[model samples]
Target: MKITFITVGKTEDAYLKEGIEKYVKRLKHYTRLELVDIPELKNTKALTEEQQKSKEAELILKKVTSQDHLILLDENGLEFTSVQFANYINKRSVTSSANLIFVVGGPYGFDQSVYARANDKISLSRMTFSHQMVRLFFVEQLYRAYSIIKGEPYHHQ
Candidate 1:
């Protein structure tokens, strides 16, 4: 199955961008990987955090199709070990043909409507990280998960 990774804004840091690209290229050896950057909202000086999120939600939802399985990378979502996450991905691949769409929301997180549309939620860690950092982390984890699935030496217990 193809995996769609959607994030808000571009990775501005050159290092972070390079790191994300590395894992993304590695991941493509395993499955189709689509990286999407929903351009950040403009002129937010007057808009409240909630309004910013609301506007972002509109853009995010537009990328999703009814056949896609939307999964949000949320702090309160389920946390899994590397092996367990690999298993989760394998299970989904065996069970469904739908695209696995994962999203990293803007600074304030996802709006309620976006949450409502999600089929599942996953947490990378209990502690919060910058949205840009999360992009690198998530892509690396995706690569790790695939390596584990293939019994590659990329991961160790």
Candidate 2:
């Protein structure tokens, strides 16, 4: 199955951008991976945070399909260890899902509509992270998960 990471906004810092690219490239050795960046909403001075989430949700939903398994990365989601994450990946690999989509929402988080469409939610940590920093962290965790699955030395018990 293809794994797609859909995130809102651009990675402005050069270091974070470079790190994200590195893991995205490393992930190719395991399976199909695609990274989609949804442009941030403009003229948000008039819109409330809820309205912004609603608009971003519309854009996010457009990239999803019924056949895809949608997982959202949110602070309140389930937290998994590296080995457990590898198991999660292994489980999805055998499924009929055409694509496994993991979304990292905007600064204000996702809309209620977006939550309704998600199959599962995962939390990288109990503490919060910047949306841009989460991209690098998530990708690296994905790579680490793959390494654990492959019996590589990247992840220790």
Candidate 3:
């Protein structure tokens, strides 16, 4: 199954961008991985938090297709160990889904509509993280999951 990461906005920091790219490249060796960026909402100074979320949700929904299994990266979602996450990936691949899309919403988080559309939700950690930084963490975790699945030396217990 293909794995796609959909995040809002661009990674402006060069160091973060480089790190994210490194992990994405490593993940490609294990699966068809792609990072899809949803442009940041423009002129948000006047919009309310709910309004911003609604607008961002529209863009996020557009990136997803009917066949894709949508998963949201939410703080209140389920947390998994490296091995469990690898098993999750294995199950999805075995089922032959078109794509496994994991989305990282905008600054204020996802709207109600986005939440309703998600099939599952995952939490990387209990602590909050910047959207750009989350990209790096998420991609690296994905790489680690793949390595664990293959019984490689990259991950340690």
Identify the leading candidate in terms of lDDT. 1
> Which runs of model 3 end up more than 4 angstroms from their true locations?
none
Worst lDDT run of 10 residues, candidate 1, spans: 20-29
lDDT of 3 by residue, 1-157 (tens): 7888999998999999999989988888899998999999899999999999999999999988989999999999999998899898888888865699999999988999999999999999999999989999999999998999899999999
Which segments of candidate 2 are over 4 A away from where they belong? none
Model 2 residue 117 distance off true place after TM-score fit, in angstroms? 0.4
Error of 1 at 122 (Å): 0.4
Reference-based lDDT, each prediction: 0.96, 0.94, 0.92
Root mean square deviation (Cα) for candidate 3: 0.9
Better lDDT candidate (2, 3): 2
Residue 11, model 1, lDDT: 90
lDDT tens string, model 1, 1-157?
Answer: 8999999999999999999889998987999999999999999999999999999999999999999999999999999999999999999999999999999999999999999999999999999999999999999999999999999999999
Candidate 3 yields a Cα-based lDDT of 0.92
- lDDT string for model 2 (21-136, tens) is 99999999998999999999999999999999999999999999999999999999999998999999988887665689999999899999999999999999999888999999
Q: Whose TM-score is higher: candidate 2's or candidate 3's?
A: 2
